[model samples]
Target chain A: MGMTFTSNVLKDGLSRIQREIDAAFDAQLPVPDDMSASLVEAMRYAAIGGGKRVRPLLVASVAELHNGSREQAVRAGCAIEAIHVYSLIHDDLPCMDDDDLRHGKPTLHKKYDDAIAVLAGDSLHALAFDLLASPEMSNDPAVRAELVHALASASGHKGMAGGQVMDIAAEEAGGDLDLHTITRLQQLKTGALLGAAVEMGAIIGRVPSEGRSHLRNYARDIGLAFQIADDLLDVEGDEEAAGKALRKDDAAGKQTFVTLMGAEQARAQASALADQAIGHLSAYGSEADILRELARFIVERDR
Target chain B: MGMTFTSNVLKDGLSRIQREIDAAFDAQLPVPDDMSASLVEAMRYAAIGGGKRVRPLLVASVAELHNGSREQAVRAGCAIEAIHVYSLIHDDLPCMDDDDLRHGKPTLHKKYDDAIAVLAGDSLHALAFDLLASPEMSNDPAVRAELVHALASASGHKGMAGGQVMDIAAEEAGGDLDLHTITRLQQLKTGALLGAAVEMGAIIGRVPSEGRSHLRNYARDIGLAFQIADDLLDVEGDEEAAGKALRKDDAAGKQTFVTLMGAEQARAQASALADQAIGHLSAYGSEADILRELARFIVERDR
Candidate 1:
């Protein structure tokens, strides 16, 4: 019954973050009453529809555990999700992956052409900062500045952008990238933002630096687990559930966890990671129950 | 003699900003020792090289008038210039303007491929915010937060991105957009960043909000003048000097200040605005001298 209750709360937590993120976009980024309407429309198109909401869930969960304000956590969630969506739009461009579908619909580039899509992504990136800078996110300006800095460090050249460059180079070079390098790349590319998400919640709660380290450890475990799960999904995820192209990494000769360690080992590693991630939270009590369940769910989920 | 002295200071001011901005890029964005090297190279490709360095100059000039720290001003200048360079890189994307060259060199997309170009631009955008959030930019965290907020407001949907949408829409609609709409478009597209440059400089100096209005007015006037001059350059500038395609705006049949007011009238309007812009700084004595000269030069410059 205790496990069931926590799972239910985790489910609600996911949906709540999704709703708040959607509303945050609508409330903050209204469609302009002119030709700029299309730009906002494309931003809305990318942001609103659907995703797993994992990043936001992490933010909200950690914030709640620390007794941070719900509204602030929700707003932070929107900010991180905006960065994630913007990245996907850029990633799916014609010169990038050139994918046409996302979440079972035509990608922004496919639906609205390339120019609008580019501006839309650029605008969403701006919106993330705008949201974080707002009073809704935090009345404390220092916290706000820290959030902006952390997000940029995670998402910019030093982090996601840097990792993306390495990803592209790996593909162009055409060989099996070493496991160590692949792990580092994934840490920068995906893990940085994921770590930022948890760190943001810690900031929201005013968690001490010593306390923050444990959260960071938890974030790192989940981040690696999430990516390993993604690699596993690509290999075996159902097309309908996954809602995007899959198994392309192997076809493209890209290095992935599954490729380096084999599918079975990768799955085992993901499980170990998820368990360790939950272990880091042992200090937090029942207040962190939802985070614990979510960790387990992340490795087990099909999509 | 006073006017000549001011002009010389203005010249050194411009060169100082150029050198400082180039050095800022070098110092802040060191290339990693991996595949990310190419991404940093692409970012360098776009951010370095020749351009007027107008935005940074505006920032430094205004900052100096307010007695802001020179080091702080140069850092702020780099932040704004980072945003400007990022904008150009995105603007030159094949899906947008299809530009092959910029500042007499190959565009990022042309030189590094489209994916690299997009990520480089995105990374630079992130770098701009990161720089603003840097400790070197300010010791006060609140000031850093305000800088981030102001830059985002000026560059985001309600600013550059919003203006870009209307511009594309104006072309797609295929008609003479009304003068009112054209003015609004340019305000968002070009004017916003120019205004932000001045506002940021004022912030760097810790100028009170009331003390900042004159700078705001000065910025507004110069922003309009800058765009009109750009329109003039398109009609009459040398391809070798301008370092990019020109006359394309007219060829595209888009609504522009020059098109609406005629080249002669547009030139006159630019001169009038430049005069008004200079007038806004009568309060600052010799400290304002460089800003006044810079305003006049903006309209008179060939490129």
Candidate 2:
């Protein structure tokens, strides 16, 4: 199958982000000796292995738009991805989601035992903040502090972890959240960090306030649209896709946009949000093609 | 019920530290409406409820020696306690230590669900670096960044979490470890953060390099002594107490100093280290009384 132009650009950007991220994790995570070999391996397995690399793409794309340092943006992306993977590791614990598989492989706990999984995830969380504040990320202490503050806010109780609490509550309460409640939950759980990705790019590039607002609007729309696309993918099998599609949400008894808005309407809403998200980048002109393409590519990818 | 002089001073100092910490936790961890009410409440439950507050006291005492700001020292202490409690929460998880009780109360996971416990622990971890970089902790960006760096190093895979991985490895490997390996593990898992607590106070107080090194040496001694004392308590109970004494380590199938070195030898070692720890404060004379008393108290506390 031939790749479309948008898909090509997205693929190219994602491949670059993956390489940069892999290197960042390698340089950042080293097993001290045999004693910590398993823990480091768990960290490496969870972090450096293959995935979509969407968050890093967003970070790099936005940072590029504002003329930020690519090296710095990649570093920031590594930090963001570290938090994302840590959350996933903990979420997949037997006492939590109990999932045995992630990224098409056995979960860390399945491979290394639960205690190692917990410690690795915990370490990754610490490493994220460490990377954000490190000299490698930014020599400017204020920028480092800002990154720490912002990333912490996005990942803390009021953000992703807090959102997880609500998500679990929603599941236990029979998966019957109204659209508004679900939106708020998703905003906290998923959207906060996505939006922070864009915002951090702006912060690194020293984007002006008005410019940052526009980027944030872009992130907000794309973040929600992305989750909706995910929900749609979950409800309706990806056409010609292998194994990942279908109604796992139903199995998990999750309340998602597709359940609330129907697949057709959810798909339409996602498209409209992508269009509006692209519109938010009007000032960036052709320079924002990657972002615009990314918005469109996110919902359309089969895998 | 007449208090001994050492107890009187320790009690007065602890009372003040407890009050300050409670206030910090209250002001810092607010449940917003209802969404994260459980998570925040759980954080309060694990953190603000009650503990020895020894970490905070160590931070305060060391900072006081260096003439650091009390408000700042207390805030830093709160951050340290948050990490300590988060570690405790995760450590007590069923997949980990499987402890049902901590600080003489039901553990967070036992009291709530595992998900809530994990999220609460994760949130407290975030709150820690957030608090460290916050204006309330320090107006200087360098100090804030230094703090974020130091605490993260102490908490990351190389430090507390790494130590935990080793601890679990030790236990799962039939609790067999040479004294040196176990000592190294304790240094990473427990001593690192404890020493960090002392070093952080020095950082906050802007202690000169020589003085900081001295404080660190003091921290190192006390840190190891504290663990040995804990092992002693585990084996022999509080020197003058009962019911908690003997064979608990044997039952837990864990190798400890008392088990490896014999109870008498362990007790002597702790006392010698405490003496050495106190010697590290020779430069401070009268100002070091509480710190000196704290070294003795750590090994001697009835609880």
Which candidate number has the best TM-score? Answer: 1
Native-referenced Cα lDDT, model 1: 0.86
Q: Which of the numbered candidates is closest to the native, going by highest DockQ?
A: 1
When just chain B is superposed on the true chain B, each candidate scores a TM-score of 0.96, 0.93
lDDT string, candidate 1, A1-303, tens digits: 224424677788778788887888788778878989988888999999678888888888888888888888888888999999999999999988889889989999999999988898999898888778765567788888888887888999989988888888888766658999889989988899999899888888888768798899999998899899999999989978988988888789888899889999999999899889989998988889888888888887777
lDDT of candidate 2 over A56-76, digit per residue (tens):
888888889878899989999
Give the Cα error of residue B158 in candidate 2, in Å.
Answer: 0.4
- The C-alpha stretches of model 1 lying farther than 4 A from their native spots are A1-6, B1-6
Q: How much RMSD separates candidate 2 from the native structure? A: 2.7
Evaluating just chain A, the predictions reach TM-scores of 0.96, 0.94
* CAPRI-style quality class for the chain A–B interface of candidate 2: high
lDDT of 1 by residue, B1-303 (tens): 224524777789888888888998989878778879989988987887586788888878777777888888788888888888888999999899999879888888989888998999999999988888766668898888888888888888999999998999998776658788888899899999999999988888889878888899999999999999999999999998888989898788887888889999999999999999988888878878788888888888867
Q: Looking at model 1 chain B, which ten-residue stretch has the lowest summed lDDT?
A: B1-10
Which sections of candidate 2 miss by over 4 Å?
A: A1-6, A208-211, A238-246, B1-5, B208-211, B238-248
> For model 2, what is the C-alpha lDDT against the true structure?
0.84
The models' CA-based lDDT, in order, is 0.86, 0.84
